[model samples]
Target: MPPDPHADELRSPPEPFSSRRPTWDDVGRVADLLAAAERTRTGVVATRAEDVRVRWLMLDGLEDVVLVEEPGPEPVLVGVGEYSTELDLLDEATVVHVEGQVHPAATGRGIATHLLDLAETRARSAAAEEGAETAIVRTTVIDGDDRARAWFSTRGFVPVRHLLTMRLSLDEPPRPPTWPEGITTRRFRPGRDEVRAWTAHSAAFADVPTHFPLTLEEWVEDRILRDPAFDPSLTQLACDPDGEVVGLAFCRAGVEGAPEEGWVRDLGVVPAWRGRGLGMALLLDALGTFRTRGLTGAALDVDDVTIGPAVRLYERAGLRIVRRIDVVERLTSTG
Candidate 1:
């Protein structure tokens, strides 16, 4: 296909290394790039992909990052982006979440514009192959960080959602809760019967396409061993007296690249268990666990549109939205 002059201007003579599938060897390289980008003197924790998770697209490396040049050794890391994937129901949602920092040394060069062009082309190609017609992306800028926000607005993404990161001091008094009537909350130990529990947990998240699926064996064999942050004690589940796991609180602390940080992967209660305060119970339970671990702080991401009124629940439990992540979705015409 002949490239449009607009998109062509974004191209280099030709890419140095052709794109390919990522392997385990690429993990370290990707981590290195993230460290560099995140440590940009700006308080932004650039990004984090779990050590055990390298799926969707390995566009995490500098290879996926295009550097615009004009006869120089230190051309500049003008732009950085990732061609990642997530599931939208059964459809493959191809994504390109990018942020371009114009190199002060390379000002007046169309580096930022060119990088966007490159990203758009790559995103379009991937989306087309995956039967996606519409494009989607996201970017995060700190509060009062007008420069970055203005930059994205100029490129056509409206700030559709807002979020903040709320921190709870582990040193403070515990606000533990009494389990609701007939509901029993227990910490999940990856033991003999956990596979069945974990499998059912995966099924609960099946409606959320981006939430990766793991068999019980996969949970123990792959994730449990690969991630240093996987502490079974911090992870938890809530069940009815009937001996069925209906709600869960997935927790992890001391992420590999992110030190002194803890995350609430997710907290959910099955529809049948809704209104029983099960969600709050599971999360508050995790908080107590964190307090016990003598941890510093914890964070979690929540969709403002969640059906479970989760935003209010997290806020009530003292978790604040640290940052806002915009989710722009376009459905392909399967007709």
Candidate 2:
């Protein structure tokens, strides 16, 4: 049989390089490369060391699959890439999620192409080991990044979703918040509310695209119990008159690189509570909390505009789109 078309697209670009796996200690340097890449491409320093640490922990087969280019003493990390299948949140049974970044200055060196080749191969091997029958490969690029998008398109990846990163300046006072009748809000209850908060958030976003609800254990490990930045004070939740959790505006005090900004990581109102203005109230309340803490601004990512009236709610809250990211995927096998 001829070479697999899917595999053909992932062929590495002609380039000479060596690679190695990264350790937890490499988080700082990896973060530096990420910041450098983001600054060169978007004129902003967005990636943070903590984000890198969290992502590293989330990856499947970290040491086996992750690649660090030009590895050696005084080596420059021109590229980093990895594939993860453990968190396949899509409806599909098996998916190998590939993500990577190349130093902006190193773009033309075919580092990204080579990285994809490594990532896909490792991902396929991993899926087989896990007893998954076939798998899809998914990746994402900023919507404004034509070069990246074109490269992926030529490789047979098709755009499947769009996510927006929205921002709000705290320079102007946040509009005064109004709590809906029969509803009250409070900071997360550290010891007692971990499961409750997860349930509320997962239920609220259950129908949203790309939302794969995590098991309670996964939720605890990822955020609530162990994440260093788990500031109970900043993460807010809405409670019904009977004191049941009904909505949440989960906020992070700031990321490692940009500590002055606040992040509304997620804001959701459970289905039964939708259309009652709880989401808007929770959002404003979170902004108010961030403002009270003297944060410079706030940000969040919306999986898409049509997920609900979420876009409008965000707009009314003074958050504006700062970036658009596209999710692309290629079916590697159908069996």
Candidate whose TM-score is highest? 2
Report how far off residue 198 is in candidate 1 (Å): 5.3
Error of 2 at 121 (Å): 0.9
Clashes of 1: 5
What's the true lDDT of residue 168 in model 2? Answer: 89
lDDT of 1 by residue, 1-335 (tens): 34333334334523331222234544544554545544553556545556324332344433444334344463323333344434444344666565444444443455555555555665666677677676555445555456556666777767655554455555664588767798776677666547646755776676663466776777666556776667777778777788788887778986444556677876766667778777787877877777677677767766544624767787788876655544333232222
Candidate 2 lDDT over 1-335, as tens digits, reads: 34332343333434456666677788888889989877777788867798888777665434533445664577777778766665365554466677888888777777787777765665576667667766677888975568889999999999888888788899988887778789987888878998788888789878865667799889888876667777888888899988888998778888544678898877888898888888888888888888899899998878764634767889999999888889998766433
Relative to the unseen true structure, what is the C-alpha lDDT of residue 77 in candidate 2, on a scale of 0 to 100? 75
The numbered model that scores best in lDDT is 2
- Stretches off by above 4 angstroms in model 1 are 1-60, 68-79, 85-93, 103-109, 127-164, 191-228, 328-335
Residue 296 lDDT, candidate 1, scale 0-100: 74
TM-score of each: 0.66, 0.77
What's the lDDT for all of these models? 0.58, 0.76
